[model samples]
Each structure stands twice: as structure tokens, then as C-alpha cells.
Target chain A: MSVMIDTGNYIAAKAAVMARPAVVPAYPITPQTTLVEGIANYVKTGEFKGEYICVESEHSAMAACIGASATGVRTFTGTSSHGLLLMHEMLHWAALARLPIVMCNINRVVGPGWNIWTDENDSISQRDTGWIQFYCSSNQEIFDTVIQSFKLAEHEKVQLPVMISYNAFILSHTSMPVYVPDQKDVDNFIPKRIPKWKLDVDNPITFGNIILPAAYEKVRKDMQDSQEYAKKLIPEISKEWKKQFGRHHGDLLELYKCEDAGYILLSMGAIGAESKVSIDNLRKEGIKIGLARVRCFRPFPREEVLKLGKQADLIVIDRNISVGMEGAVFTEVKAALYNNSDAKAYGFIAGLGGKDVTFGDIEKMCKKVVNGKAKQLEWFGFEGV
Target chain B: MLSKDLVEIVFHGRGGQGSVTAANLFVAAALKDGNKGVQAFPFFGAERRGAPVRAFARISGDEIHLRSEIYTPDIVIVLDESIMDMVDVLKGLKKNGRILINTTKNPKDFDFSKKYDVATVDATSIALKHEILVGGIPVVNTPILGAVPKIFDRVTLKSIQDTVKDKWKGEQGNKNVKATQDAYDGVEVDF
Candidate 1:
């Protein structure tokens, strides 16, 4: 009668994908290993009935998934920092071909010095890769997002790949209580594969062929059109998910107590939860502060952000850096709020290589809001060099 | 709301101290008791040794909804005392939360007695006494778990014993079963 509770993101991910009966193709990568490993264990123990392919590398993993998804079956795979980079070429093709593949990416910092901890560099770097990316802050979001990813990616107007990421080591290894919906409810929420297009042997349609300049522009334009059309479908799917699951996070931009607040703490991934705590503590102290959590990053959610920016001062806290270009997220946030003349936004870079973000750091940031002095681009919890 | 009483327990340690293995063993104990739970580790992208790593276990009677990271851990188990200076392991620990430290040192060595009920055990010595190699299976978590009833009045040693027997099947299972008992027997209190 009630929902089943579970934890450990890997098990939730495995149970979700298996319940959907996906044809999974995965390879082992640190952090991202649990999802594929759990699925393998399920198939090995005869608990789940799905074709779990053990590939050699991240590249082959996505390639196998692309092939499987084109065959008209729901497909799944997972990867991390460099693993995602390795799949970069295939990711573009997967999106261009309009295959609805759902992937779980355990957000890890891409390395130049061989450091492997939690960071948003991997998923953030692929921000413009034509896929619908959703950053989940919790284990439950990781589970629910994967389930919603299928519907969003397979929608008639949006046959694109989707990735749901949570910070590596933070949410990946953090064991918190999570609610898993029943198989019957999930099946009802997402009916058996209603793909927009499939590799129909009888229908005989061509795919991924060479295009000359004359027709190449049209193909590219169509891809752009599909993505633009997806902006509307995202909220539509979120509405459906709420109708079935009773929780709605469908906004391109979700604001927290920003109605009366003068300053807004904007962050993606898991830090948003930490920001909420900071905001709550500050609010109790009689300071009006809020948080805007970005759920859909791919379509940029530019319109939703502009609409929300009408009320408050924005602070963008990014876990990834852009080297000489301010912060990666700061640049994007500024661009999103560029047209809004009434808003002033600040940027912060923090949490690289799995560095822990404590409540103290968040409280300190809130103090800046209380003081009414905000920087253009700053690093949280970092001191003098 | 009749929500499930889900408990989040975290283990902080160096790479080789058996924190992860201990967490898994605890899950096995819980699962053997017919309770559903998840055992997992935070594998830092780099697999090198002696890095400060963490493992987690979530045990509950009902489905959990707050799927966020365990910011406020109900129980904090320290396998290696050296990690205290690197990160704030006690940051969001609940007031009067149980702190299980695997050490020969007294609880006076650490500050903040008001926030925690510190339980010390010479688990490394116990593991060595039982001939569990430092590089081998982490046998300290179970023995430290023996002190659970003392720290928290909810879980019982009998529940843990039944859990170990259910998880570790057969004769080899019996050694671990004895190991659980020996671990409970080995709890050393440091005031």
C-alpha cells in the first residue's frame, strides 16, 4: 500500500532501471560502479530479468547503449569524470541520433594531477553536449530522476539523451534514507516504451549518415529545433511525475523562500541542500535569504531564471572552475540574468576534488548577505594564498 | 506522520583500517535480522592507500524520504583517530550522539564531551589478539558494535548475534559468529 524505502544510491539506481526493464550496457568506474554492479548482481542472483552487458570502457559502454536504445528498447549506462570524457564523442552522436538513453553520472572532478574525489567538473564540462542534464541533490532524487529521465528523453518532441548527476563521494557514498516507488506505480507513471522513433527494420529509415553542406545546416537546425521544443516538454513531464509520484520539482528553476528574501543563494547539485540549511538558520536569525536550485541545466532554463530573478539578488555557488573565465557556473548564471536589469548577482567557486562544504562555510556566506556586500566571483572557504 | 525511524551511521577511517568492511559487516548483521538496509563506501576517484575515506549504512523499518547526504549522523564511528584534524568529522553530529572510537587512548584526549557520549575500545589490540591481520578483514566494527547496547539502549547484543549468525552461513559463519561475541567481549572502556 505504501512506498518501499531504500538507500545507497547504487541499489536505488539498480532497482529503478531493472524495474523499467532496461537493456543496460555499463563498464566499471570508481564511484559509478555500484549501479552497474548492483544490476549485475541482480541478474546473477536471478532477481531481475534484463540484458546487462559488461563492456570494456566508458566509450564502449555508451556505444553499446546507443545500439541498444536504437533497437527500440529502453537503455541505461553510467560513468564518472574521465569516463564521461571518454564517452564525449559517443555522447554527441547519441544526442544527434535522437536516442532516448537514460544515464546516471556520479559527478567527479576531471584530473590533470590524478586526484579523484567529488567535483562537478565532469558533468559541468558536458553542459553543452545536446543532452538533457539534471543535477540531483539526494539519493531519492537520483532514483526518481532516472525514472523521470526516461519519460523526458523519450517524449515525442525531445528524443535526446539524459544524465542525472549527484556529487561524487557526497551523495554517491552518503547513505541516507530514500523512498523507492513500487514497480506497479513506476510502470503506471511511465508506461512501456512509447519511443518517438526506433530502428524499425520494416520501416527502413536511415540514421547518422554523412550530410553535405546543403542539407547539413538543415539537420543541425532540426537538432536545435528539437532541443528548443524540449523546453516546454520538461515542465510537462514534471507535471506528469507529480501527478503520479506526488512530488513535483518540474521547474526549470526552483526557488526556496525567495518570495520575501532580498538575497538568493543559487547552487546546483548537493550544495543546494546545504544552502537551504544556511538559509533556514539565517532566516531564523531574522535575515531574509533564499536559494534557487537549478533542476534542468541543459536547456539553460534561461526563461525560468529571468522570471525568478525579478525578486532577489543572486549568488551563484559553483563546484567547478573556469580557470581565467571567472567561474564556469558564474559565467552561465550572469548570462542567464543578463537581460534582467533589476537583479545583481554574485559568483562563488567551491568544493573541488571532494572538499567538504560544512554548515559553517554556508553560514559565513550568509553573513555576507546580512552585511549586504557581495562579490562578482569569489571562492567559499578558501583563504589567502 | 508515521514515518520509519531510519538511522544513518557513518564510519570515518584511513584506507586500510577496515571501516568499509566493518560497515558491510554491520549491514550483514542487520540484514540477517530480516531488516532492509544499504551498505556503501565513498571511493575517492584515486584508489591509493591511507586516504581519509568514509562508508555509510542506513537501517530503517519504513521507506525513507529525505534522501540527502547524512549531514547530521546519529552515530559516528572512528576507525582511525588521526583523521580528526583533516576534516571536521564531528561537524553535524547530533547532540549527545554516540561516538565509537577505535583507540587505546582515553576519551579525555578529545574535546567537546557535552556534545558526545564517547565510547572507547582497543579494537586494534582485540583484532591482533584474535589474529586478524591489520591488512585483512576489519574485525573491529563488530566488536565495537558489541558496545552498541551500552551507548544506545535500543539495539541489543542478542539482535547483533542473531544478525551475524543469519548473515554468515555455515562453519566459517560460526567463526564470525564467535568473532561477534569476542568483539562484544573485548569492549574496553576508557573514561
Candidate 2:
């Protein structure tokens, strides 16, 4: 492995090129532009011997990926915020088509106010598109997850698209040191994609016609089954990656000192990583609290959340709010433990619209939850009614 | 305030002045000097030419987990001395934190130098001397980086020159390396 000091976007770009995807089609968006630029550089340098399509829009970008993946070629792309929103229709199409297209979606604030910063709503809103999702905290995690997502997506048991999301400016723009394994190591770890089925002119097959409810329900069930299979396969691939590369950013949920703690705080993306600092500080103050940094959001890690609930009460620091209900993660974790564990879960709506959520702010939230002073949910940094 | 183990720095400059590049190169040099955890990021907003822009950098012996913006910096580097009047570059700086500026004036000329450690380097002159110009405007980022190792020892003048070469190549790279060395020898520190 060689140490690379660069931004998350560039690291991810290197990881994607090293993975050796056959086709990379993308459009530029803030925070994600540099990533694509990095790939273009590799292409220019002849390091990446593949097709790089400069599509006009994100919609066309995904369309290009789907078209390329339909022919049984490995495909990759990236988008964020409005760019991701523009590709919404094709996102479902790619997942439903069962095309194993790996995408790195830089999580950014969905704009009504023309703002550009780190936020989760962009990818969080795409949660139900039948794609396996992974949230990363650091530049290394971003690189590793991008490489691993390709392996997971192309697996036979789990032929589903994977969306790897991370906080935009926090991860995309921030330069950090990441150890990039040799191309031989990466190529050995994940071989080129070999789809079980694909379009062949000689083989002549019709695809994606309208189906009746029975067949449609089976297709949906197949997607769900594939997702369930991904949960099991993600850890397996992660383990093999660690065995070869000597690093593991956890499987579904990265537990931080939660074994014997009475309180477990949960968060995802950059906030999840930041929570570790708060956990360390609180532990020094003699608080029996730990952290569960959710790495894989879908395949939900419901079982792990339930297990943590049985071990300790959960405090979720969600970076995305569902507007009316609460944080999407907060609701999901609460649902995971429904009628199972009596351990209550509290939700703190923090970092929405890219508001700063510092370690000190996290400490305050943890103290509120641990002291039994928190209600079911509250907006952090905002006075409640 | 930053922990003793971590070094947080803020870069202040106008757009096209390479504030973000300075932060990135600073951390890259630190990484080459064997620092494990280093991060550099621009202000999370749109950057326009001639607009005041800020970038942040951090150095730690261990992996950095805190992802928040640098609010309390241990060092502040100003790439454009003219920006110091428009922006509060010293905001949230730790007491006695080192402040480096790209200016022709002496370090003691800055009144705040009496209160905090201050360093000055005529980086614009160094950049011009090395013919490091983009659009006929001198690019002070690399030269200013050479002044950094004087105030912060975690990175070195050698690594700074090496990183500059890594980012650029051939004649252009040699010029940046020389500009960096010139600033290294030219910097004046007052503590």
C-alpha cells in the first residue's frame, strides 16, 4: 500500500480507476467535480484504459451507465445534490434492472436556497431506490468502500447497485492521507465484472417489458432478497479486503466501545466519525456511553441496531430530517427496536442544511440523553417549544 | 481550542491567490514528514476570483476523527496582506498562536505581533523572482508555504519543495522549489 495525501474526491477517483471499471460516465457538480476531474486526468495519463463519457447531465450520465452495464461491463459514476436529484428516475431504473453500477454520491444539501455545503439529504432522500447504500466518514473509508462496493455489487448473490455517500465538503474537499494498495492487490481482490446475464446481439433477448402483479411482486421480492444477501456479503468482502489490505472500516455498523456501555450514540457520514471524539471525551469524564457509527445504512443493519438497543439506549444524531416526522435514521433505528428492546432511542436533528455539529455539540447531546433529560426528539441548537 | 496533540491552521487569501492550494500543500508536506493524520479543505462555499476565501488545515499524530470546521486555529497564514484589513483572520486564534503573512514589512511591524507570535515573508517577491505567475498575477502559495516550516516544525522546507515538485514538473517545478527555498531563508519571525 502507498500513502496518498489528497482530498476524498481524488482518493475515490484513484480507487475507482484502480478498480478498473470499463466505463465511467459522469457530469460535474460542486464537491464532486474534482473527483471526475481526477478520473479524467488518469484517462489523460493513460492510467485508465477505458471509456470516459462526459455526459451533458446527470440524467444522461446514469442513462449512459445503465446502457453500458446492460452489456455486462463494469460501470461507475458520481453526482451530488441537484445533480443526483436529476438522475432520480434512472437511479430506480438501474436498481430495478439489477445492474451492478457503483456510484459515489457526495452527500450535499438539497437546495432551495442555492447553498453548497455538506449535508445528507441528497442521498438520504434516495434511500428507497432499491440500491445498497454505504456512508463513509474518512478519505480512506471512501476509497475502501468505493472499491468494496464494486465487489459487493457484482457478487452473484447480490446483483444490486451500490451508492456510497459521504459528507460533501467535509469529505470530498478535505485532503487526508489514504493508503492506496497496489493495482495488483486491488485487481486481485476484485476481478472484472462477469454478469450472469446481459444483452448479446447473437443471443437475441427482450428485456424490461411491463409485467403483471404476480411477476412484478416477485421482481420486487428478488430485489429485497438481493439486499438481504448484500448485508451478509458486505462483511465477507470487508473481511477479505482487510485480510489482504490490513484495514476494515467495520461491516454494517462500526461499534466504538459499546460492549459494556449503558448508552450507545449512533450517527452516520462525517457526523458519525466526529462522534468518536465526543465518545472519547465523555468516557474520560466517566460516562458509560459508546458509539455505533453506522457504515451501511441500507441493508439498514436493523439486527445490529436491535442488538445495540438491547445492550444500551440509542441516541441518533441524524444529519437529515424527514421534515414532518424526524431524522430518517432516528425513525429507522426506533423502528428496528420496536417491541424488541425496551431501551429508548432519542433523536437529535443536527447538521441539517450543513449547520456545524462540533464535538462539543455532540457532547451536549450525549449528556442530555444519558442524564434522561432528552425527550423523544429535538432539534439541536434550536430552542424547543 | 485545539488539543495539544493536534495543530489547526487557517489560511486567508483572495480567490486566485491559492489559499486552498496552500492549505493542501501544507498538509501534504506535513504528511511527507511522517505525520499520520492531516487534512486540508477550503471554506465550504462558492469561491470567486478576487473574493476573500479561507481554507483550513490540521495536523495530528494519530488519525483525525473530528470533521468540523476549524474554529480555533493554532496558526493562521495570510496569503494576501490586503485581506487582513477586510477579514478577521485572527478570529478564534489561540493565544500566542503563530501568525504568518505574505508581506514585505518586518514581523514586528504588525502591532498584533506583540501579542502573538508573528512571521513575515515577502512571498510575492519570491514568486515574481521565480516567475510564478498565473494570468500575470504572482502566485504566492508555494513561496508562502516555505515560510510555514519556520513557524511550524512538523513540516520541513525540504518536504515543501518536494511536494511542490510532486504537484508540478520540469522547469515549472524547479521554479516553485527555488521560490519555496527563497521564502524559507527570507522569512522573519518575531515571538
Candidate 3:
């Protein structure tokens, strides 16, 4: 039965426990601290039969998960902004080792001037680290994605780690009703992780040791191949998950009222949820605007994005900037549609460091696009440069 | 008064006064009353105990899609009476919006703008009477929340009581329930 719960972190922790990961190694960080704390509570109550280890730092957290996954056991961990960046080397190590570990990363601002607010730059920075990334917009989606991630990552054809991320504090601290499935049903949906290769006492095999340049090249190719395979497997898993769970959050991208839209608002994470309300309000005003929410960022969803580009003029709203260039999503999206279609892509940078982005702000952006006044690269809700 | 089906409320209190808990409990009570959508979130930055804090809640009959902080609220609840001395509690409140404060003074004793409907309840005394204290500070959030349903009428006192019972158990739960009942009956409002 589904119960109303406060915060997506608790739902994620509940889903992780339900997945029955054999090892949970995590360190506390704001926004993500409660996720591991909730797991510890489950362990203390004897509800989850797993080894919960409190690591010294975020680097050690991912390192512990990598070590545990090497032993062929299901492993889970959680971290945020600075913590995730701190685990940069191990993130590559876990992915290159082909460990199908699942983690929840709360998208907080990476700070030189200390901040704890929501921003996507933290996870977006790890796009090239060979992890399948899923950005969730709601608490229910967070729960559903965490469970589906285990299935998607553990598939023999796609043995890559998956990072499930959501806007820090926006989804993390917000209270909402989430439909949690029964443990028996979840177990049936997601079976125990059984690795094809593992560290065995008798076998005596070395893992992640020294390799020649040619072998290293082959490993890189294999990792890319697995990611390409995941693009196909993601939708298949979503279909089966919908059939079993009665909920579907699209495959890589979810389209909202885009059937005959002349203009489309493209966004991700919590901003996408706010855009839904903007689209609804705009539609009532007789504006033909729609929203295409990118759910998975790492796999890029290039094909689906190209299809949407063909449908309407794409206005990309990105919360993370690419420093000297425009928004990260904008740069990639513009490239994705460059040779294929003649879609005018307008990029808007907004909500960095967790500035509030509301339906009113989104409505104005869409109206500007509709009125042909949107710049090639504009900042939403920012008065001055 | 706002005519929209959605009702937004802002809770102003000290960091350790349980204002965030009050916002959560209000949403929980609204959910129990069959309100389809409810949300609550706190806004703070490296706050310590006794520091000014804010939290927001939204209750609607439909699913809520907006995740932004509440810029305009239909009601504002002040859990700390001293907050008004430091900050303007009525900054973004809608015209004809309501203000509920935890104070021993009468509603008209404070110099509030004439546009608002002010209400006051002695939640501190009620918390002390119920012994809902943590570290020598009275827990005034529950009593303040109890006065909310009486003013708004969208959520019921019964729902709040039931939610309190569902969240707590035994004597602790019963004490909170009694505090809620007393605050609901004792709150004085002036329009």
C-alpha cells in the first residue's frame, strides 16, 4: 500500500532497503545526509539485513561501495555536491570496473563560497564518468527510478553504475504523498543481484589491476557499448515497470502536451515540474506551448531530443552553466539538432545556486519565445549580468 | 481572502521551535482530510537554535506542480511572537489575508495593518501546561497548528487530532491532542 511520506530522501532510502542491497557505505552530507540516516534507521530497527558502514568521507563512501560490489554483492550509497566531487576518482573506478552499483546524488551547488542549495552542475560535471544518470522531478519518481535503476544497471548487457539525482532541498526537503509498493511486489519486480563475475576465494582472480594500452582501449570501448545498449534497454524496462507498478515516467524524456505545440520548453529536474504548471497556465491563455522534460541526462537521450527538435522550436532551460560557453544542455541539444533539423534552439540559464524558479518566470520565458524576443542565450529571472 | 482552491501558508518561528514540524503536520492533517495535494518545506541557511527560520506549506484539491518558495501566502502563522519585532511577518501576505500568532496579548493589542484578520492564542502557556518542552523551551508548534483549522475551516480539528495520534502514541500523543483541543477552543480572532 502507498503511504504519504515527507521528503524524497526517505523514499529513496526505503526503496534502497527494499532492493535489499548487501552493503551500504555512505557519509552524511546536507540534503543527502538524511538518505543514509534513514538507511541506518532501517538497519537499527532490524528491517534491513545489510551491512551499513559509516565511512569517514565521501571518497571513502564510493570506495567502500566499489570494494563491496567487487565481491558480487549489491551495494548502495548516497552523496551530494562537494561529496560527489570528492568521489570523482572512485566514480570512474566503479564505472570502469563494471560494477552495477546504484547511488542517489542530491544535486546541490558545488561551492568555493559555500552553498547548500539545489543546482545540477554537481552531477552534470560527472557526465563523462560512465554512469547512467536519472534526474527525478517528484518524490514518487525518485522512488520508482531508484528501484528501476537497479534493474537497468544490473542487466548483463548493461553493467554500468547508475546515478539517480534530484534537486537538493526542492525534492529532498519537500513533503509529498508517495506511493510505496509492498516489499513482496518489489522483490518480485527486482530480483537479487547476481553478478556474472565476482571475487571468489578459490578462483583467485585479480580485478582492476595493471592493463596494457590496447586492453585499456578495449575496456573504454566496452563501457561505451554498454551505455549505447542501455538506451534501448531503458524504455523496455520502463514498459515492464509500468505494467507491474501501474506508473510510468517515460523512458529517457517525458513529453507534456507536445502533440501540436508550435513552441516547446525543454528543461530537467524540479524546473521541469514547475514548467508543467507554466504550460498548463499558458495553454489556458491559448498559447500553443509544450514541455519536454529530460529524465535521463547521462545517456543524453539524443535521438528523442532530435525528434522533439523536429516537432517544435526548442527553448532549453538549464540550471547549470558550462562556464565560458552557454548552458550544458543547451550546447549539447543545439549540437544534437544541428545537421538533422532547422530548429531554432534558445538557451536560458536560470535557478543556479537554488534561486526560486516559478511558473510565472517560466511563463514569461515561453511568452518571450512566442513573441520572438528570446535571445540566443538569455538568463531567466536575472535582471543584471 | 484568496479565491483559488489552493491555500498557501508561511510559518515564521525560531530555528528550534518546531515550525517545520508544524508545517508538516498541517499538510498531513490536510491530506487526512482528503485534500488531494499538500506540500511543506523549510527555508534556512546554516541556522542555529533561536535563529529566525521560515517554512512553507501548500494545500490544494489538485496535484501541486510548483516547487518554488511561496512568494505570496494566504495565511501566515507566527510561532515566535518575538519574530514580529525583528521582521515584517506580513510582507507577502495577500490582501485580507489572516495572521495567527502565539501570544498572550489580544488580537487588537498589536499594531497590525487593518487589511489583515489577526488572531492570537496563548500556545506557550498551553505547551507549558502540557509539558511539551524540549531542552527548557516549550513546544508551541502543535498548539499553534491546532488553532489553524479553527480559523481556516478547510481542515478539521478532528483531522489534526487523528494525525497527532497517528504520529505519536500513549501519554505523549494524548498530551498533544489535549493541547490542540485547548488551543482550538481558546484562540481569539478579530477581523
Candidate 4:
């Protein structure tokens, strides 16, 4: 029923097929190309029954998904940095129209310098786009999260698109053992997309034709309300999923040995996984440090973060920079903790453009935190900052 | 074989030489042997055929949460002997680490750090002997990988054979199995 496989892309593709999406429109990009290619193979081999559309560009890819989603069928798509940026307008269109399309965005650096390496700037820049984001730390998590995204997005209480992301090539190209479930179990988990409103000839409706400013405000408010609803629904669904599948990645944040710790390090994506190793090594050295891996970024996990702030000194590690300011997560955490807690928060920016950030680098950061010599904003693994 | 410590390995080869695939297969084989945690990833900017590339793998007795690139590897597996002339393959290798090179020359002929235990095998010949060629390029990855378990106790030849058989089938699989077994027996290690 389950097998060990290499690459997160293939695992994501397998999960997509098992979810039985009616339509999948995707374009080829570095790192993300293999994901759609695997889907295309499934389609060719007759293992997957979905319509796999090889669109011209990332813009066309999202547009096709939007078109398919409007017809009340389950739709899926995947893209990387520039590809995702190209779908900027359509990203907004899908969210506002309330089409529950699920997409996987491999986090690659946006290029003027032409980099194809891993970075979170691509997805972090889309934080304001109204799409619910889930950052995965492992191949198994990628498979599980992509499968969970469909059920969460399609929930009537939360009809919003979900962007599942992991670092480009780190999880994408990395090989690991992932336990894939049988199709019957997956069917029991995720039901078919049955929308209340759809483009049907018998039941006519108008979508995105014209909206006054006041109506647009209400529509935006409803979207925000659904996001609030999703924050609560995410954990419930994860619990149900765990009850059935025997696995549950913690709701918005996965805390590792943080129950009784003086210092807690916060991170997202692959860096979070690396920090766990750092925490384990640090614990052996008698340092009271732990890791709180942020699973969902769009909802921002305000309560969980505030709870962490109350318990320990928070060290936020960001693979992305807000530019002219500190790291994006640091900025969000600081804003969330304002007037909420007096916990000292330090920001460390690391692994931009695929720079390697190891356990030793993380342990050093923890040591600095322990020494109380950490700056408010520091560039990790950078010398002579 | 189970060890308390994690075994980290770095692979050096050209882009087309299947170093990344070798790394993945190695980890897959380790997982098949019931190792709790395993990870393999490639590090490249703009990869192309004939360009030097690096890939890394880690096999741990416990769950591996570290996703960072391997800095100090326990073993450096060189798939191509020519890459040795281009870069210091021993750069971040541990002082007691082992060097496994796919070369026809003897291990003593090469100048390497005195701390490392060097091993050599004629993987290209084995690949050619097995006629494992992809687009006329002899597939040396499997043969080199086969030599790995011979030198290290972390994985066994049977596990490598089973993984290979699962990956490739029919006559192609048989050829790979034969190449792997031959290389496993032929590898020469100097402590």
C-alpha cells in the first residue's frame, strides 16, 4: 500500500492522482517540471483519469485551472518562482471567485540574477494574495499536505485556494521514504468537489462580471472570514486525518521539545527540519532550546506564536528577506507579538538563493541566543555582516 | 548493519554520470535495509552533461531531521576519476573518513590526505563489461554504488541487488545486478 520513493515532486504527483482531481493544468518549469511530468506519465499510463493539460506558460496554466475549477470539478496545478509570479493576477482571480483549486508552488528565488536555487521569497511575496499557504518540511509531509489541502480548501466553511510549498530541490529533488496510502483510503478521506454554485446551463449564474466598491469590500471580508474559519478547521481536519491515516503534522505549528525550554527557534520549510537536528544536538550540550516549525504561513498562526512568545525567547529564522527590512517571518512574528507578550524575539536571515544552512550553523545561532549576544537582525552563515 | 552514528556520504561525478541517481539509489537501498532515516539530494547551480556536480546522502539509525548539505562526510565516493584533478574531493571529509574512487589505477598511485582510507574499483570496466550504456555513455553509477556496501557495513550487496532489481527489470536488471556483484567483489580497499 505504501512504498519508498525519491523526490517530493513524484510524491506530490502520486498524491494528486490518488485525490482524483478532475483536471490538472500545468506548465513546465525547473524543479516543478518533473511533478507535472510524473502526472503526465500517470495519465499516459492510464493510472490517472484526470485531464492533464500542458499549457503554454504559467499564466495559461493557472488560467486553465481557473476555467476548469469554475465548472465545479476538482482542479490542480503546480509552478515555481517566475511561474507563480506570472500567475499573480490569476492567483487573485481564483481566490476572489472562491474556486477551491489546489496548487503546489516550489519555492525558488525570483531572478534578476537568474538563480534556480531554493528560496522562500517567491511564496512569501504572495502572502497578501489571499491564498492559504502550507509550507512542507519533508517529502512525506509534501504528499500528506497536498492531499490535505484539497479537503481543507473544498470545505464549505472554507472555500479558498491553498498553495502548498517546499524549498526548491531540497525537498523537490531529495529522495526519501514516504508512505503512500491506498486509493480506497484516500477516497474515504477526500470526497469529490461538489460546489453549491457552478457554471451549469440549467442553473445560470454570473461570476466576476462587475462588482461595486462596497460589494467588493464585502467579498474581501468574506474571504478573510473564511481564512479565520480555516485556522480552526485546519487542526480539526488534521486530527481526523490522523485518526484515519495514523499520521498528523501538527496544525499550524509543530513544536519539537519546546514544552520546557528557555529558547525556542522558529522556522518554516526545510530549515525547520534542519533546526530539529540542531535542537537535538544542543539539548545534549545542556542548552535549553527547541524548535517550532511553522506549517501554515497565510493564517500566520497568531495564537500559537503568541503562546511560544510567552514561553521562551523566540528566534525566527527566515529563508526570505523583506528587503530594506528584516526577514518576513520575523516581521510578522514581531507584529503578532506586539502588546501580546514581552518575549525577546531575534531574527536570523539564512539560506537565501540556495546557500547551505547546516545543523552546525543553527547550533551556533542557538549558542549566540544562549549567550544573549544575538543582534535584532543577523545574516546567518554570512561573515563580516 | 546498524550503527549508532549517522553515516554521511558525498558523491562527486559529472552531470550526466548519474551521481544524483546513485545518491538516491544508495539511500533507497539503505531504507530498504530497514534504516530508520535516509536522505539524498543534489547540489548544482546550472547542471549540464560533462560538468562536475555534487550529491549527498545520509543514513541514520534514528529519524533524520537535518536537510542541510553534508559538510563533513564520512565517505567521499568519486564516480569519475577526472573530477579528482578538478576539485579537492577531500575538502570537508572527516579525518578518519574513507575515499572510494572509480578508477583503474591502484589506490596508492593517487596523492590523497594520509588520514583517509582509500579504496579503488574499475567501475567503468564493469559497466562496459555489462554493456550498461545510456546513449553510449557507460553507466558507472550502479557499479560504483555496488562497491559502496563492499567497503561499508551500513548496507549489504543483497539489499543493493534488490533495490536495483526493483528499479530496473528484465535483461537490463540482470546486467546491473551482475555489474554490481562484480564490482562489489573487485573493489580494493587500503586501510
Please report the candidate that would top DockQ against the real structure. 2
State which candidate, 2 or 3, has the greater lDDT.
Answer: 2
Question: Candidate 2's residue-wise lDDT over A8-72, tens digit each?
Answer: 99999999999999999999998799999999999999999989999999999999999999999
Off by over 4 Å in 1: A1-9, A19-22, A212-215, A248-250, A382-385, B1-17, B21-138, B154-191
What proportion of the true contacts does each candidate reproduce?
A: 0.18, 0.88, 0.72, 0.78
Considering every candidate listed, which one attains the maximal lDDT? 2
Residues A42-113 of candidate 3 have per-residue lDDT tens digits of 998999899999889999999999999998999999999999999999999999999999999999999977
Residue B23's C-alpha lDDT in candidate 4?
90
Candidate 4 residues B1-191, lDDT tens each?
12358989999999898998899889889988888789898985678999999999999878778887887899999999999889889998988899999999887877773567899999999999999998999989999988998678889889999989999999999999999999999999887
Model 3 interface CAPRI class: medium
Q: Could you give the CAPRI-style class of model 2?
A: medium
Task: Output the lDDT of residue B83, model 1.
Answer: 86
Instruction: Looking at model 2 chain A, report the run of 10 residues with the lowest lDDT sum.
Output: A376-385
Q: Which ten residues in a row have the lowest lDDT in candidate 1 chain A?
A: A1-10
DockQ, each predicted model: 0.22, 0.71, 0.57, 0.58
Give DockQ: model 4: 0.58
Model 2: number of backbone collisions: 0
| Per-model i-RMS | 6.5, 2.0, 3.4, 3.9
Tens-digit lDDT track for model 3 on B37-155? Answer: 89898993677799999999999998788888898899999999999889889999998899999999999987773678999999999999999999999989888888998679889
